[model samples]
Structure formats: C-alpha cells, structure tokens
Target: MIDKLAWIRIENGAILTARSHNRDTYYIPGGKREPGESDHEALLREIKEELSVDLILETVHLVGQFEAQAHGKPAGTLVRMRCYAADYHGQLAPAAEIEEMVWLTYADRAKVSAVAQLIFDSIHQAGLLK
Candidate 1:
C-alpha cells in the first residue's frame, strides 16, 4: 500500500497548498509515510518538514480518502492520500524541494494533482469552496 498524508489547511476559506519544484501541478502539503508512523504522525512530521511549522494534531480534522494515479508515474502507480484539515503554528513557507506555495480555491483544480483535483471536486460538492 502506497500510503500518504495530506494536510488540508483552510486559510481565509482558501486551501493552502504547495507546488513541487519538479511538477507543474500543485499538491496538498504532505508526503509519503515513514517507517512505523501512524497517519496523524506522518502528517505532522511531513507538515513540519515541508513547512517548518508544527501542526496541532488535535486541530487536524480528517477529511476523506483520495485514490488516483500518482502523477508523473506509471499508470498503475496509484496513491492513497488520507487528507485532513488543521491549524498550525508559525509562518508557512516553502522548505525542502518545494518550489512555491499558493492558497488555491476549487476553481484552480486543473493546476493541482489528479488526486487533489478529486478532493477539490468533493469539497465543491459539499459547498466548502467555489
């Protein structure tokens, strides 16, 4: 199982996301699972590593599961993204290999990952975004 954790942070009603330096599309602030880490732990660690912010675990709200073909990989290279909404501390800026950070609305779906687009669709259907 290719597991991953995604942080769905809603700021001023817009979702805070990042675009990898190597990819054209944006993605949720997240990463692949680490050894023996739970979903929440992985999310916290990834958020900290990528954004240099400590995510409040208690504030992290589970959104839903998103499964899609992993971008830039083979057709069968699927990913299961477990998403969440959360509050965090410190200013969010690009770290590691991230190229840019953007607050995106549902209208920018085409600029995000395939699985991220699915999450955007669901968020729109639920009346959470435009």
Candidate 2:
C-alpha cells in the first residue's frame, strides 16, 4: 500500500489537479509527509513546493480519506489518500516536478489517478462538482 496526502481545492464546480513531469495522469495536489511532521506541516510544505502557494493554516480541514488501486503500480497495490480542503494565498502555478495544472470536473475523472477518481465521486455526490 502507498499512503499519501492530497489537497482538495474546488472552485466553480471544478477541482484543482496537477500532472507531474513525465506523468500522464493528473493527481490532487499535496504529497507524502516527512518524518515527524504533522498533517498540517507536511501539507503546507508540499503545497508550497508543488504549487508555490501558502495554505491558510486556520482554514485547513479534513475532507476525507479514500483508497483505490494504485495507478501505474502493481495491479493489487492500493493507495490511501488523505485529502484536505484549505484556503490559500498566492497564485497557483506549476512548480517543482509538476508539469501542468488544470481544473477538472466530474466528467474528466478518467484523466486523474485512481485515488482521485474516488475523490471526484465523493465531491460530485456532495454536489460540489459539475
């Protein structure tokens, strides 16, 4: 199993997603946490490194945790994604290894990672995605 953290940013019925360099599928922003780091710390650091944005510490909240077959990994490999929603400051832009950033709706689910597909379903069911 691969454990990861992700940021959920929905605006106007679309969610923010990123595709890293050399990767074909997009993933929700945020990444794995470093040792001894709290969820907020890791999330803050990852988002800054990946998107060059600062998450408002007080606005961060857990959205949900989801699991699915790991995309591009062994057939049975599972990925557990802990997702959070937060307000941020600064312009969103591709940074670090991210090659592209896009806003995706429910109809575009197939373009993202397996874990992200589950996230889309949850968001859509909650009436957040178009």
Best by TM-score: 2
Model 1 TM-score relative to the real fold: 0.93
Candidate 2 C-alpha lDDT tens digits along 1-130: 8889999999999999999999899999989989999999999999999999999999999999999999889899999999999999999999999999999999999999888999999999999999
lDDT of 1 by residue, 1-130 (tens): 4678899877565788898787788998999877888888988988888888999988888899999998888879888999988888998889998888998998788898889999988887887776
Residue pairs of candidate 1 with colliding backbone atoms: none
Distance (Å) between predicted and true CA of 33, model 1? Answer: 1.5
- Name the runs in model 1 displaced over 4 angstroms: none
- Every candidate's lDDT: 0.86, 0.95
Q: Positional deviation of 123 in candidate 1, in angstroms?
A: 0.9
Residue 80 error for model 2, in Å?
0.6
Return the lDDT, model 2, position 104.
Answer: 97
TM-scores of the models, in the given order?
A: 0.93, 0.98
Error of 1 at 68 (Å): 0.9
